[model samples]
Target: MTSAFSLKRTLNLARWNAVLLTRNRLAFVYAVVLPVLPILIMLAGERGDPAVGATSITTVFLVVGLFPVYYNVLSQFVSRRDELVLKRMRTGETRDAEMIVSIALPGIVSALVISAVVVPLSQLFEQPLPVNPVLYAAAAVLAVIMFTAFAYWTAAWTRSAEAAQLTSMPIILLASLGPLGASLADSNETLARIIDATPGAAMNELVRVGWFGFDGAEATEKTLSFAETWSAAGPPLIVMAAWTIAACSLASRSMRWEPRS
Candidate 1:
């Protein structure tokens, strides 16, 4: 007979996994330091400036999703499988879904924590409170789903934890496209369209609309009212949703639970 789903057991495993993640100094840097660096840079040079506000927060949001959520999750799955931990766990009461969720939980929480802190912290730089906090919340939720799925999907080809460094480069470069999407639009509209269709650019759009109140890609004299934000969010939302679905599907198809020869 199958065991019933248990939230308590899942959380316990997640807690232990979190401890492991935090203990690694390099992982610690990815989880904490890299995500916050953009904000610190903005503060040191342009304290309380609104112009860079959305850029800074969006950078933190995207950075957190990439390293902690994406890279760490990829590394953990590879390392655990190589050590036979995943295979061993399967011999017991743990369900496959439960195990996967638990493995992805810590990075999800770290991403959320960074997202939450940035809202209040943005005020320190004299930026206004987010005009559409709901959009911010929505983006954060989608980010966790998308990036974590990306990690699992990427883990399929990763031979070992060390191999993760090379495997994760495409994702890193994908994320790097976020900040450059708008700039690219000016010179090469077609290339810019492709970038905008990507998950990172979709996130950048959401941040620009939700946090800074820009209307779509173009800034106007007035900030968008409450209702306009949702309309602006629609395209990016679709892009992110499509990517999320693709990632989850690929992860399920390709993930390996046992060590390689």
Candidate 2:
């Protein structure tokens, strides 16, 4: 027989998910508008820049497109996870894993929708197709998962749902400016070495390389060398994994079913 707590938690998640999503119009805009706006801006700028061809423009577009979808949406998810509703649901039948997944599902769906809109629209506007679709696709999926997990980890430190907006700002800001960070790091060996040690920088580098089709054995060798030297992506992925594990452990240990004191 189904446990009473699980049933109640599931019901609570379904109810709160709908209510919060419907009530928060700003959340809706952030999901839909923020990612798409950069694409529009890129299209507009492409008309004037003779030097900026389809490939470069598409690269910029992809990087910009990901900011709102992954960063903003995930931030919002983390923030919302701390609500009284969530606190109450934890008291019910739902497992901690179930609660987190249910909370994230809506935002994940929205991110996927934005991604769908981005690809075709980019092509329709004559932006070149991504050079390495497989690599890009992998990077995007990895990014979403990593960021989502990171959001939860961040939420653990946050005091309340209201604080999510402020607490999440640093991540959103970093993600929004990731491309710039990547470029700057690329030029400065020392800075690049430092940024390469950052959490999301490897994903950024991989995506940029994949999107731009920096291929051949030489490129692969260089990427692998960079991977070994800076150990950017590998270390971050491991850190994210550890963070996810730790977050789960913490949630299991500290999570309260009833409202916070």
Candidate 3:
């Protein structure tokens, strides 16, 4: 049972998150401007050659776009989680769940905005609409949840706000450079198998479905036929789910209400 007042406060906090994000010029650029730049570059470049197909371009953009939105936002949120602002909110009527929601609201909104921009822009180059919009949406939402939780967990271990950016580098780099996740989403059986094992690979697969319609059967066949190895993409989804749970559990157990002791 939730109260209207609590909901209102949560909404207000969400809005405040957006305002605070805008105030930080660096964060604003990281969240908004950075993701779109590559897309523009791709659009302006040559649109020929199967090597640079719609599927590949979209896959690249999706992966590139998520870095600034997910990594930066998560790092920022986690870095600030122990600030006086969060401490003050925790002492008030704001529930822990609401606090988390409020903290995440800005990133969520920014991701949505970035997606809106990317989808149409990709379409302008003749990329097909998602075959399964439902699954695509599910993957996108799950990605938001997974990365948000991961960021919080990372923040819990982080020593300071400055370290937030540094601490987040591994996940960011992995998401960017990991095998098959972004690079092999279109092809490369070996890479795809490797990507299926990584943390954020499921979302990469889902984005492929959105951009190029990757069905379960097709994915399974691709794995079996080309890769000659059964990928754990399905299992990776489970792993991602587990990551969500683990991140939440870790944050609950170790998250400091204020700066380190």
Candidate 4:
């Protein structure tokens, strides 16, 4: 009985949040546009190089998975807090976890949908299909979870909806560097090690391994066999898992249900 009620409330909250999201014209535009922008940019410069194709596919997937969580979920959380919506919701039957999940569902769903489209369409665009679908799926799921938790973490500091953009920039930059994980590994081993520990780099490394079997190292000239070994998949999975735990912990501790007065 309680479980059923919770599910109903969660679904209703998600639906309401989705409607609010679609009503925001600018955010709606971003939801529609940002997922495709990297693909278009990559496709435009695609020269049939397998290495480039692999990198492009990794970049597109990471961007699709991370950007929406940063831009949409974080902003919505801040906006709701500033407007006292979260405070009001808390006074009702909605639990904190449900509220967080409901608010994040729309952006997370958008990111997942884009990722689903990007993966297959990537092959059509002449990129290799994901050689390890399980690894790719795990990485993408972790990306969404980590980013959503980080969104809440950022919202703890963001003063208003206007501040969300600025607060989110640091994580955005960190995740944005993920696409360059391969090149960075080749050029500067120390820097590559540092970046690989981050969630963004984890996303790209997982994709690299899944698509090109190359674990974010210097791209080889020849096509490689699909390598889904524990050796290839373990490190990034650990990194993402650790980050997800830390982010969720911090967000739960620091999150403010009411506007800062």
True lDDT of residue 150, candidate 3: 71
1-261, model 2: which lDDT tens digit per residue? 454335565556756775676677776566555555555554665543322223343343344334434444345554555445556655655776667666665665565565556556666555545555565565656555656655665565666656766776766554544445545754677876666544455555554455444332113212323233233334545543553465456644654433345
Candidate 4: stretches off by over 4 Å: 1-5, 220-228
Greater-TM-score candidate between 3 and 4: 4
How does candidate 2 score on lDDT? Answer: 0.52
> Where is model 1 more than 4 Å wrong at Cα?
45-48, 218-222
Cα lDDT tens digits, model 1, 190-250, are 8988998988989888888887787755463237887898898899999999999999999
Give the Å error, residue 112, model 3: 1.9
TM-score of 4: 0.90
Which sections of candidate 3 miss by over 4 Å? Answer: 1-5, 44-69, 78-82, 177-194, 214-236
lDDT of 3 by residue, 1-261 (tens): 554347788889889878888898888877767656656544665553222333454444445335544566565665566466777777777887787777777777676666656556666665545444554455566667777777777777787778776887876765555333554556877776766655556555555544444444134212222121123235545756776788779877876667766
Clashes of each: 1, 4, 0, 0
How close is every model to the real structure, measured as TM-score?
0.95, 0.68, 0.77, 0.90
lDDT of 3 at 5: 42
Candidate with best TM-score:
1
lDDT of 4 by residue, 1-261 (tens): 353337678889999988987888888766666777777655776655567766666666666655667678888888889889889988888888788889888888888877778777776667666677777677777888988988898898889999887888888887777766656677887898897887777877777776667744665443345543446778888988998899899988898988877
Name the candidate that leads on lDDT: 1
Q: How far is candidate 2 from the true structure (C-alpha RMSD, Å)?
A: 6.0
As a TM-score, model 2 comes out at 0.68
